[model samples]
Target: MKNLFLCSSFFDVAGILPNFLERINSNCIQTVSFIDIASHVEEYKEYVEKAKLAFEQQSLKLEVIDFNQSSDDIVQQLQKNDLIYISGGNTFYLLQMLNEKKLTNVIVDLINYGKPYIGESAGSVLLSENIEYIKKMDNPQNAPNLKNYKSLNIIDFYPVPHFENQPFKNLVEQVISEYGESLPLIAFDNKQALWVLDKTIILKDET
Candidate 1:
């Protein structure tokens, strides 16, 4: 019952957002909480800035939440916000933090119980059926204690973001071939996204 905006990349929002987010009204969006994972890795931190800027450009206010915060604090933020935007990062590390902090269930319950959520890259991967499709992109060793690879299963199909072109496209093919037998996979470019409202699902591309 939760509506979701699963983005491929927040950096190119200026090009993809108009047509992709046509169904959503910016005014209706009250508050947004940015669930950040990029900070865990020094390189992915820029993604957080891009994400925050993307939302601000659309007049959306946000609160940033990272692993340093407690589950209770995260839950409080989730309860106060109208939307949750989980940014891209090391998927393995992100999942590790989620488990280590015991916040996985809190997030799953919130989103399933009807909290609007947004994800880019690793964030998108976390909500899928399992992180198996991204084995090539993330290091499993980063999350050694992870017992299950199962994802939130918020969406029936698996979506691989950042499949812009060439080598990335080829990687997508490999992922699809590996998991396509049991799970339907959707590929999205940096300028594309998957929008879910109510029970309907659709793909959104740059204008």
Candidate 2:
């Protein structure tokens, strides 16, 4: 059976990450430590602590794995989780490392086994087939290196996060002209998101 998939522009502000965790029974969340890949060892402890505190504010418990120590160590560390939350960061680098460590299969298993998965920004982008279509405002080279690289493929369409933040009207049109309109483009503003649950997409607006 396929698990539920959740994609958000920004966890709490744009999506219901915090709220969703709070609403679940026990008011606690089961999260993996994928973002630790972006930090140094010295900073990871504090980072995880702060993340726990932030989630706990909304009654969630953020569990992290020191994937830096060994990316192969993620599977065991993730054994008890029911909900995996992927935080925001550099998508290209993250996917590169994940592939290097061969943790992508483990992540796919988590999703296929009825575990509810949540992703934000970079994390959300990895759920799609391609991240090359997104325009980088700061770095022109922010695009992922693998054009045919694999993603979790949890979402049916391609995603363009931070959509309304830029002049997407023209940029989107350009992409459509090149890639064809048959390609799905799900756009989200900083305060808006498109959520996927059981293969159904829902539009969520911030209050």
Candidate 3:
């Protein structure tokens, strides 16, 4: 049961599920979207509902799980899930919550178990070994940092999501400069994608 790490700025693609769904056991192909841990519990509920609507519109079968739940509780929910989607939000906050909940290890096990994964925005970026390339809120914005926020290491290098979108290009350049030329950094514009196969990665249009 090999896994494919499908990366996207968003998962609005209608056929996205079927493409990989057919490859894995139906029961194993589950979808979980990670929301911004920075938001209040009430606000996060709204976010999850909207996400559910989007997936429903596509007629995709996704069992949404709120990672903000108690750390011990998350493992039970994740035991059988296949695809865990991480939505865009504060990258550092997301990692902080993940570490606090101890859900990262469960995620690693799920991926190793051949459960496919998809991420958008913060979700996509958090999988990299380091998300230092991402820009945080400055004087105008309030962002939280939980110690040294490192990513899940699901991918070998850093990921630059939302390229061609505001402020992203600037940070990407900085990341490249800091990491040097040999790093396997991936940068994609909105409506573009990085598709994962057993042992290969392909870029495709959002449609």
Model 1, span 51-125: residue lDDT tens = 788788877788887667778887888888877888887777788788877877788888887777788888888
Candidates' C-alpha lDDT: 0.75, 0.57, 0.60
Model 1, TM vs. native = 0.87
- Model 2 misses residue 103 by how many Å? 1.0
Q: Any runs in candidate 3 off by more than 4 Å, and if so which? A: 5-8, 11-14, 23-50, 61-63, 136-145, 167-182
Candidate order by TM-score, decreasing, is 1, 3, 2
Q: Pick the candidate with the highest TM-score.
A: 1
Once fitted onto the true fold, the runs of candidate 2 whose alpha carbons sit more than 4 angstroms away are 1-11, 18-53, 135-148, 166-182
Clashes of 2: 0
Question: How does candidate 2 fare on TM-score?
Answer: 0.72
- Tens digits of per-residue lDDT for model 2 on 1-207? 443333433434523555544433324444444354522312223433444555566554566665656754677666576567666555666666677677778887777765666665556777877655543421224334534446767777776556545443565456546555666877666566565655567677778
> What's the CA RMSD of model 2 in angstroms?
4.9
lDDT tens per residue, model 3, 1-207: 435444434544434556555645454443554344534322334444555665667555665566656766677666655466666666666777777788887887777676667666667777778766565321112235366756688767566666666656676566567665766777777666665554566666656
Better of 1 and 3 by lDDT: 1
> Which sections of candidate 1 miss by over 4 Å?
14-26, 42-44
* Residue-level error in angstroms, candidate 3, position 75: 1.1
- Evaluate model 1: give its lDDT: 0.75
